[model samples]
Target: MKNRSNQQKKSDRSTSQGTSNIALMALSAVPLLMVLGNSMLIPEFPKIKSALDINQFQVGLLITLFSTAAGLSIPILGFLSDKYGRKIIIVPSVLVYGLGGIISGLGATLLDDSYLIILIGRVVQGIGAAGTAPIVMAMVGDLYKSNDRSEAMGVIEAANGIGKVISPVLGSAVALISWRALFFSYAILAIPISLGVFFLTQEPTHQGQKEKLSSYLKKILQIFREKGPSLLISLFAGMAVLFILFGVLSHVSDILEKEYNLKGLTKGLIIAIPILFMSSFSYLTGRYLKQKGKFFKIAIITGLTIVGSALFFLPFLKKPYIYVGILTIMGLGSGFVLTSVNTLVTSSTTSEQRAG
Candidate 1:
């Protein structure tokens, strides 16, 4: 009976994909790769700092530069992708992303001033990173009609969480062989994935009148004024949630190794549990919202409250297991917030403003 039930479940799970869905799945790799490029580096910080002959503060700039570049470039790139086409921006962005990785790997290999060169490469990666993730999100809006958009967004968010889950383990394993290999591996993986997305996916149709820069700027301002506090709240809340998420994850390795005497694969496995909660919950939330299609505002508020509650009590914890338990709770809120709010943003404007 158990065997029959297992077989039945397997049969039920099997579903087919069209060329577009296939392409969308491949496109999902951009965020996964984008995340892996950074998150994987968490465990490698000591190695990088030592090899580059840099201090902790200078070493920290590697993350800051990539994030700074991505943040600065996203709005501009979103506008361009909207103006031009998703494919044009995405293809080139992937190429630039690979080039940046290659350059970073080479700098670490051949140069004395590896720090400066790798920093430049990371900045370049950030520039490329800026273009890809948002374009992919915009592509989701472009590719799927409104009914299917939420599911697509959920899958992408789950992919992002999965990448975070995998990065530490993958990074740790690869570091066993060579820490520099992780840099090159992203370049190697990116080329083919980008190409697959390019060839398989059809470009989303752009219609109607094109606006001048002045007109577009005015329209964007108009959107801001109309959306007002709602948009502002979403933006700030997204930032704050992630600030807690990454900020906590950033310190995990040190705490686990120093406090608990854990390292390597064991450490990586331990670090991944909360993130796994995030991904699984994100997938479920996406499905839930896709069907129920209500409580979006409520869910977002609830998610924020849950995250706040988790952070408030964290200072009193002693056991590593309890600490991780709270982090998992934080992940639950993050997953909820990610699914609902992202769908809101993607659904906010269906046409020209969707990408912008």
Candidate 2:
């Protein structure tokens, strides 16, 4: 009788631990999908630009559309999720994201210019994405204690790296067949992920009762004012710079051919080299963060590395190898900075605020 009772207790304990691990893993998926959706589009941009006959400026706008929408929507949805619940916001967002993917694919097929339609689809994607990534990070903060939270965030970032690593190759393969297919593929990816999230994940409750919108906004403003306004400003500025870099890199093949006389596969490989390094280093950084919780040091190092790389590029502006080296350093620096910043942000806020 005693042996049987002990065995059952052990089994229950194991089951509880297993459940907790799965929950953490699921939280990681939110960021993973967010990054995957964006990264996949990178390799396909050439095909998209050529098919739509869009200018560089127009191509840049497509990225801007997605990011701007995401930025506007994240805080709003985060606040709503804090008031209502994460699952309520998340499930609908996933569905909208899938719809956006379908619309993007259809727009690519049906529209004469297609750029406008694609832009609309990207905007929808951004809106839907707002609820998932940030909310998931907030949820992790709610679920885990401080020490564990950093590791959880690192795991989430690692998952994102996995998605980013796969996206380029997968997108290239899909684009080779049909550019429209890439968007449809994203829709397919979203459906199963959404279903899983809807059925499996539980919405975390705030520790305290919800605050008024005005109050919440006031608190957010206070946090920015008190904790790290200058740091936050610098981070946002860095993000904008990175976005511009990504936009330019997306058109590297054209630049290489137009300016340097590089041709075909070589141009493709050159562009890809930096991305490969970035993905690899991002994964490594995530792993490092999981083991060590030196957020400020990582952030500072990342910033310095980026500044140094940018300076290095100025000296060898025309050399392809120098560009590649700079990009690799930039990627490593970005990975370190992003992971550190995310950890800091999540830690700074309460669970409710994080959700907000």
Candidate 3:
């Protein structure tokens, strides 16, 4: 990282125009859409169950299927994106995502027990998701000069935060019209964003080969071996941060609706409060990396500690403000963890190695 930092400093001296902020705004939509789509679905789960005549177990699979498919496909897509270019992979992925959404939307509109078709749509969307956010991470690193890199990365992270903050509200608003419209919204988003990436983003300069599938898998293992044990720790830490945030949110929306007797826009607004803090702090962390990067290890440790402590106290809270305050507090730590881990990975590799 020090070496990369020094290199970035040298590169920063050159006034490379690189990717414009406009282009970045376009890329920012990817993550914002991802989180927004998922969080919005959380509120829609029960509604979807009723509309589709599915049981609780099947309703659960709406989220589960999407995640499982995305998780499984990312590694493979990572390799393909490396072999090809980010543009080539991303355009198709976005289109596939739109197709999935359309399928789900049509299924919901046309049939009552269209659960099977909707499930298929989610699976397709998940497969497309495999290429969306992960590839964007690699592209952000490729598109910026080192000095601008942190800020660029920050903006994307900020967009992610913004998504979290607004998703519930947006989702609630959209669902008011028809829950089926929610699926169409995914299609609506994917099309323009895909076109933006295709036309606006430049093909990055890199030295990676289009490896044979056999060799690609072998190289992935080799990367693990070369980086040694600390990589595992980093991976685990990043995993835990996302795991905690998503796991809590998965139940939080329902709990608020059922236990606290909150619903609709009010529920969404409440859910967004703490997440607003998380996004704000994530942007701040990225912008001030020159100072904070010096305390990377400290930031990671301190952030996790704050998260754990806040979450520990959440179970005892009785008021809405208390929940909001605790999550806001947790967001500070989450921002640190997310920004640090995201920067570590994005900055550490070239466009090619990032694919693995």
TM-scores for candidates 1 onward, in order? 0.80, 0.82, 0.80
| Candidate maximizing TM-score | 2
Stretches of candidate 1 exceeding 4 Å from the true structure: 1-18, 49-60, 140-158, 204-209, 289-294, 344-350
The better-scoring model by lDDT among 2 and 3 is 3
- Residue pairs clashing in model 2 are none
Residues 188-244 of candidate 1: C-alpha lDDT, one tens digit per residue:
878997898788778757652366667766776787888867777887777677767
Q: Which candidate do you rate higher for lDDT, 1 or 3?
A: 1
Candidate 3 lDDT tens digits, 1-356: 99999899878754344447667888888877777546777766657766787776787688778888988899898887777777788778888888889999999899867889999999999999888877887788778879989888778877877788888788878888898998999899899999998887776766566588788777667767877465666667776866676556655666776688887788778767767877788778866875655666677788899889988988888677787787678778888887777776555555556664
Whole-model Cα lDDT per candidate? 0.79, 0.71, 0.78
lDDT of 3: 0.78
Top candidate, metric lDDT = 1
Candidate 2, residues 250-320, lDDT tens digits: the string is 76545565678764445545656666666676567656776777665556566556845675564447677
Cα-based lDDT at residue 208, candidate 1: 27
